[model samples]
Target: MHLDQLNQQYGLPELSFGDRQRGFPVIKIKNRFATAEISLYGGQVLSFQPSNTQADLLFLSDRSHYRPGKAIRGGIPICWPWFGADPDGLGRANHGFARDRLWTVRHTETLANGATRVILSLQDDEETHKIWDYAFELAIAVTVGETLDLELTSHNRDQRPMTITQALHTYFTIGDIQRVKVLGLAGLDYIDKADQEKLKQQIGEVTIQGEVDRIYQNTAPKLFIDDLSLERKIEVCNRNSTTTIVWNPGMEKTATMGDLSPDAYQRFLCVETANAAAETITLAPGERYTLGITYRLL
Candidate 1:
């Protein structure tokens, strides 16, 4: 929908729609508890700042692309149908096509508790079939308030069963990556993506030192990020998610990413809630699954 139509139909005192930087249409929401921005182009939440906080909880790269077919370099990017590289070696996009397509605003409301709710949806079409050949519908409902709550639901619209892996790839802003210690993953086993997919165990709390890319399997439902420099602890809680991915490009890899500066690694860390690897989902026809997560600053 056009910006004017969106504002006409769904705009509220706390929510409005308009073009953002580089002509990207977005939904801007502000309530008594917090403020947030959601880009329709990628169906992604790009910003969320609580009223009690001095900084945003999410990280977005300054040099990130704001165009079609390009995934924004930060925030909560949806990795759907598949996560990471092409699992079938078909040479497709790294994180699937959901984040590269435009999404329709399906619903919006202001909750009784003063939170703002927005739902964006995408369905399989000719263009999507040309890539993956499946009939499906994906919807992400974002509730913005003192805490950010997200629920991604996928439904099988085809006659056959569908298998997929996905994630809520959350890049969290921090005072310093080195000072962040991720709790709740102690003694868990992980697939070290940066170390040639080797299996490793977390001895204690996870920390970022180099190019860290590990997928913790069968993860705990809740995790915490202790940011000593920021003097805060961010709580990550999830349901129906079996895997957690922790990543940072470090210095050397950051130099190659045009969307990220060399020092960008120090400002954010990714702690993803996902159904990937051994946790991939298979849905029968007319079936659906939902992945839910909530982020709170404490």
Candidate 2:
């Protein structure tokens, strides 16, 4: 299906509940330079564009095949405060409250550069505080320009300090996961999720296989995703985030995702620039921290 048709069928006029829970809203923002649609529910980027071309879909949503009750099939799923399953973590869910809450559209302003930025903010509410006690605020400003810019800020308002791990958790669309190569994480120390204590030294390009999940530590500022099928390079540049997560659930795990097609594993790969593992950020009372990832098409 075309991007616009997908939006017309699923896009929201205002905030509304999605599959998983109650009180979430789907928000859409657009301007002359680009059109971006996102749901405050999962903070999922439904569609992004640079000039009229579709930039990213993040996931593949297939209602016909459902696994988890309300989870959508495709589009990026925002993993914040924690990346994957954190059974020992404070919250009951795998990821934190950032993606599940309804975010208010704070403002949308046109920049001097002729680009438009849509700012969305979500604060911890009664429902959130019940699970996680931190009084926090999250602001995400999506700047639509020649390339897409995502600025994420987390503010701690409580009297005590809090430490948390976060990630933009992007599922970049590709021609084939096997044909794609990720660059810029060489010679770094990473804990192979397949084996926790065994730190594998990253020496060359990244290749995905059997339940791959690793946190690349003290990484450089830039990473590249070369998609051979699309004949395009996605340059991912990070600001404020120190760690990068490269993951794909592979064949067996892909079956667990209800919204994903059995063949979905072949079409996408996640090269998430994150602040997880040992890089958990500590926010003092009233202090705020920011992390950004910019996607430039080459």
Candidate 3:
């Protein structure tokens, strides 16, 4: 767990470790272009802000508890095996267990491009086997630079095939949730999670009038978060991902969520890259699947 030797070997101050409440390890990376905080508890990225930026691009709730087994309220949460609820009518935790388990840090280095790269791995244990009954290997690789790159790979080690749905649930800091417009989901049919999972078509760019939760399928690989209030746009480039989810708790639900800050709902929006709903992924023995997304400001 010591990085001093690795740091001296790499010739840079690459990684520093600290405890996030209750003695859980958190890794901090200071690269040439940006700095980030990653929690090994769930391989969750808690913060990422580039150089010379006043505010972070990712929104992390100040009210979030840094306890074990509870997922943080913001940032990039890795949702795997299942997205929203139990897929087979069994009562399991919402959004699976990957975000709750501690992951092993496999590699950390400064890349040739001067970017910081960190790799983490997690495998099924007795607890996970009791819940999901699947043997698999999951790895998350994140590259920090002017732009953020997150890639998640899942490999099946079992003799049988299994299906799973996942998402890189990302919370982005916005100037105002009421004024931000989500582009690139227009003209696509989506499953509206807010309206009893009704099928609907997005007539134009998305506007959040109330609480919204929709899953758009077969979407374009590129999306944009045009923040009119901030006068900045976030370009999102994705690969090997079929579904996109847009969510906001709005005024009412935000009051009910205990983990969110008092004004958290008004300052951030979630535009997740997903393989969920009907677009589930099936992996055979020895097969691997990767889902990746990159975010940058323009």
* Top model number, lDDT: 1
The residue ranges of model 1 lying beyond 4 angstroms of the native Cα positions read none
User: What TM-score number comes out for model 3?
Assistant: 0.95
Each model's C-alpha lDDT?
A: 0.94, 0.71, 0.88
Per-residue accuracy of model 2 over 1-298 as CA lDDT, tens digit each: 2334434543333222233323334445555656656665555666665565554535445542232224344555566666666636544777665666556666656677876666777888888787677788888887766777888888999899988788888877877778888988878889888676578899778876667788899988999988887788889999998799888878898788766787788888878878888888899999988889888887
1-298 per-residue lDDT for model 1 (tens digits)? 6789999998999999988775689999989999999998879999999997888999999999887889999999999999999999999998899998999999999999999999999999999998999999999999998899999999999999999999999999989988999999999999999999999999989989989999999898999999999999999998999799999999999999999988999999999999999999999999999999999999
Q: TM-scores across all candidates? A: 0.99, 0.84, 0.95
Q: Give the per-residue Cα lDDT of candidate 3 at 42.
A: 84
Candidate 2: clashing residue pairs, number:
10
Rank ordering of all candidates by TM-score, starting from the highest: 1, 3, 2
Tell me model 2's lDDT, rounded to 2 decimals: 0.71
Q: What RMSD, rounded to one decimal, does every model reach?
A: 0.7, 5.4, 1.8
* True-vs-predicted CA distance for residue 64, candidate 1, Å: 0.4
Model 3: per-residue lDDT, tens digit, 1-298? 4445434443247677767666567788787799998888889898888898777889989888777778888889999889998998889999999998888878887888889888899999999999899999999999999899999999999999999999999999988888999999999999998899999999989988889999998899999999888888999998998799999998888988889966778899999999999889999999999999999988
**Clashing residue pairs, candidate 1?**
none
